[model samples]
Target chain A: MENIILTSSPTTPYFPEVSFDIDKGICEIRGESYMEETYKFYLPLINWIKDYIKLIKKPLVLDIKLIYLNTSSTKCVLDILEILKDYEDDSGQVKVNWYYDKSDPDMIDEVEDFEAESGIKIELKEF
Target chain B: MTSKTILSYKGPFYIELISVFGTNIRNFNDTYSNARKKLFKIFIELSQNVSNYSENFHMVNNVQRIGVGELFLKELDTAYCFTTINQVKRTDAEILAERCEIVNASDQMKLRELKREQRLNSPGEKFGARIGLIQAVMLSKNQLEYKVENINENFSYFSLTVKIDKY
Candidate 1:
């Protein structure tokens, strides 16, 4: 499968930067994500993971460095983590590292909530 | 309690305006303020709540529905009050008030749980308001303050305010 990349731009600040590399098994979503059409943006990322698991069967590392996420986009993040959790449960190798600004404690709480909801071990990194 | 007004706007809450307002709110807060994170989150959730569900809305190019509302950011002695007001059907106002009551009654943990439960659903016309309220309470660690002012038999002005404590 081909890789996907969406760079964040100041002109369109509603969406975040998304990079899903199929070969390297490293995917990253950074910046703020509160797009009005959240599903249109996130569903394909979900489907890409499904395809990677089915076709490549390789280890995956997901990096999330989001500062702001609306509730709807928050759900999409959970969905992505759920897919990873399922992959890990099936004896596949996957790891998630979430980066946050040191000044923001709420992101820490949010990552904790994601862990509680998806039952995935997400390492927190401060930037 | 008296509050110092920081910013205020009244008009259609279209997508472009929301983005501009969101950035303006962020720029208004200090980079080192511990309250910045919660303040921004509450601002986005509540404004988006109005932009999505407020009854008085206009169609943009006959495709997009942009809600008309007023948003205010005010500084209290110990907190920042982020509020939005908009016209809503009388029926929807009751629903909004009930949701506020539910959110205010829940503590942080419960609010988080409620937010998660409501957030699992997909995004659409039904996705924003309830979950946004829960997230606002969860982020701010404060009870929601709201009002429903009757404008007519079928419509009322719904105002929702949340306080983010400044540390």
Candidate 2:
């Protein structure tokens, strides 16, 4: 499987930093995301994960370190998590880690909500 | 309302305008970082609802369609009130009004459960009732108030208000 590396830029203001390394099986999304054109930006990332899961047959690790994300962006993140959960359900190796500031209990609660909703075990790393 | 106007905008709810609003808001309310962040988040979530789903639209360069709406902020002695008004289909207005009732009626824990069910049951569709309203109420720590006024038979003017209590 070929590796995909996307460099993060600030072209559209608070959009997240996305880096998807297929070879290392690590996909990280960081920074703030509040874009209204949510689907246009996230659909590709979702598809990339879907394709990687189908073809790579390797353990995938997903890391999310968002300072803040609008509700639309939250839905998009769930979409990605749903994909990972499906893959894991099929006996494929997958791990999801969500990093948040310890000061923000809301972020922690948000992660727990995601875990409960998706039935996916997400390791929480607090700073 | 004895509160003074912090900011008010009435026009198209284009994407770029959201950034402009955030910048102006940060400039004016820089001292209160926590409250300002909450306000900014609530503002983005609520205003983007108007941008994405507002039935009112206008053409730009005779090519693109843009959503139109009104957003206002007022600083009270103990809290800040945010309001957004836009045009929506009568059907959408009805659904939104009902949703607001459900949201406002529920306590915090119930609202959190509702948000969970909402996110879990949400279809993979690009747009629908997602976490926006839930986040708005959560951040504001107040009930959401919505009003729908008749604007012909198919469309109505929908207004939503959220209040963020100062800590």
DockQ of each: 0.50, 0.53
Query: Candidate 2: lDDT of B43?
Result: 89
> What's model 2's lDDT at A68?
82
Each prediction's TM-score against the native?
A: 0.92, 0.90
Look at candidate 1 and give me any clashing residue pairs: none
* TM-score of chain B alone in model 2: 0.90
Candidate 1 wrong stretches, greater than 4 Å: B29-32, B121-130
Clashes of 1: 0
lDDT of 2: 0.83
Error of 2 at A16 (Å): 1.4
After TM-score superposition, what is the CA distance of residue A127 in candidate 2 from its true location, in Å? Answer: 4.5
lDDT of 1 by residue, B13-130 (tens): 8767788777877776465266766787778777877787788888889988888899998887887888899999999888888888988888887887786677665453336324
Q: Which residue runs does candidate 2 get wrong by more than 4 Å? A: A1-4, A8-11, B23-30, B60-64
Q: At residue B141, give the lDDT of candidate 1.
A: 80
In model 1 chain B, which range of ten residues has the least summed lDDT?
B121-130
